[model samples]
Target: MNLQYKTIVVTGGGSGMGRELVIALLKKGAKVAAIDINKDSLEETVRIAGDYGINASTFVLDITDKSAVEETVKEMLVRLKSIDGLINNAGIIQPFAAVNDLDDKTTERVMNVNFWGTYYLTKTILPHLLTRPEAHIVNVSSMGGFIPFPTQTIYGASKAAVKILTEGLYAELKNTAVNVTVVHPGAIMTNITQNSGLGGPKVDNNDKNNMALSPSKAAQIIIRAMEKNKFRATVGKDAWFLDKLYRLAPKFATNFIGKMMKKSLAQH
Candidate 1:
């Protein structure tokens, strides 16, 4: 679907890739409703929008609230006129620890923000999207969703749910005008750990291997994928490489990642 003159709603637009996506969409001449739990961050996003600020609107609300999501969508439709696209970009990572070592509250919080939040927004806005001539839905899953990681089991599980959910939607919407794309982003430069109140080394896009893709780059790829109505999109070199590797050798892929992570953690 053409993004030009269309209206898109982006969750977690306060910062990171979500913020970058909002800006990128504006550049494509699309109106955006930026939703986030942080009012200040949303304000910053709108402020940086510059001349496109007029076309960009911000909503400060917790996506984990089902009632709030429904009401927000209602208000967003009134403000944006229509919802042509929905991007489930807001997510959080669990603390770096084994699953059994993690607390129930932390796990639930991770699941609520990453999985249920996406579900609620999609459920609320999907009916409206189907009513349109053409629409797109983009859900941001993580590499951890496909490959096992030592410390982020809960995070991986939540994202894996998103992956399956997106795929199921794609399968069901095959004959519809609405397109669904699931994105598996490798390590992109974002404050996900900080935002989640967890501590971890963030990926650097400048790495020689180019393992980490910038948020802007990821957003660009996502926009392109949506236009082409692709079923799945992978964002970074690491993501693409690992995805193929996992498909070929799931056991080896998991073990390799585990060893590398162990070494990295030891060094830290």
Candidate 2:
């Protein structure tokens, strides 16, 4: 579907790819309702948008709260007039530890933010989207969703749930006006570590060979996928490569990823 003049709602719009997605959509002649838990960050996003900021609306919302999500969606529709798209991009990672070592609170927080948050927003907004002549829904699922990371097991599970949820939506909405796309992003240069209240990953951001994809680039890829009505898309080389490898040889791919994670953890 064409994004021009469309109104799209993006969660996690305070920063990272979600912020970039908002900016990109505005530049493409679409209106955006940017939602985040941080008012300051949302303001920064609006400020960065400059003149295009007028086409963007900000909502400080905790998507994990079902009631909050319901009210926020209603407000967004009132502000934006109508909703043409929804991007479930908000999520949080668990602390770097095995599932057995992690506390219940941390696990629940990750699941709540990553899975339930997406579910609530989708459930509430889908009815509105169905009423539109044409609409789209994009869910951001991590590459870790499909490939297990030793220290991020719970995080991976939550994202895997998102992956499946989006896929199911796509299948169910096949004959409908709403289009669904699931995105699997590899490592990206974002402040998710700080946002999740954890230290940065051990990887060097300056290393050209290992550098993560820029948020802007990832956003562009996602928008393109939505325009084409793709069932799924990967945002980085690592995600793309592993997705193919895993399909070709699940055991070999899993073992390979396990060894890589083990080595990376050992380095720190």
Candidate 3:
């Protein structure tokens, strides 16, 4: 579907790829309702939009709250007039630890923010999207969602749930006006570690050799996938490569990634 003049609602619009998605949508002449948990970060996103800021609206919302999501969707529709797209981009990672070593609170927080949050927003806004002539829903699932990452087991599970949820939505909405696409992004340069309330990862995220994709580039790939109505899209070369490898040899790919990650962690 053409994004021009369309109204899209993006969660996690406060920063990272979410902010870039909002800006990119504005550049494409689409109106954006940028939702984030942080008011200051949302303001920064609008400020960066500069001239295109006029087409963007910011809503401070914690998507984990079902009631809050319901009310926020109503307000967005009232303000934006109609919703043409929804991007479930907000997500959080779990602390770097094995599932056995992790606490219940941390596990629940990751699940709530990464899975249930997406579910609530999609459930509330899908009805409105179905009413439109053409609509789209894009859910961000990580490469970790498809393959296990040693220390990020629970985080991977949450994203894996998102992957299936998005795919299920795609199957159910095949004949409908709404288009669904699930995204698997590899390592990207973002503040997700800090945002997840962790000091940092054991591996060096700042290293130039990490080959992490920029948020803007990731956003562009996502928008293109939506325009083409793709079923799934991988944001970076790493993600794309792994997707193919995993399909060709699931166990080998999993063991390969597990060993690589373990070595990387050990080095740090």
TM-score of each model, paired residue for residue: 0.96, 0.96, 0.96
What lDDT does each candidate get? 0.92, 0.93, 0.94
Query: Model 1, 206-241: lDDT tens per residue?
Result: 678755678899889988998898999999889999
Prediction 3 global C-alpha lDDT: 0.94
Tens-place lDDT per residue, model 3, 49-112, is 9999999999999999999999999898788799999999999998778899999999999999
Off by over 4 Å in 2: 201-210
* For model 2, the run of ten residues with the poorest summed lDDT: 201-210
Better of 1 and 2 by lDDT: 2
For residues 1-268, write the lDDT of model 2, one tens digit per residue. Answer: 8999999999999998899999999999999999999999999999999999999999999999999999988888777789999999998888879888999999999999999999999999999999999999999999999988888999999999999999999999999999999999998988898888787754345677867898899999999999999999999999999999999998999999889988988887
lDDT of 2 at 204: 47
**Runs off by more than 4 Å, candidate 1:** 199-211
- Model 2 steric clash total: 0
Q: What would the TM-score be for candidate 1 when compared with the true structure? A: 0.96
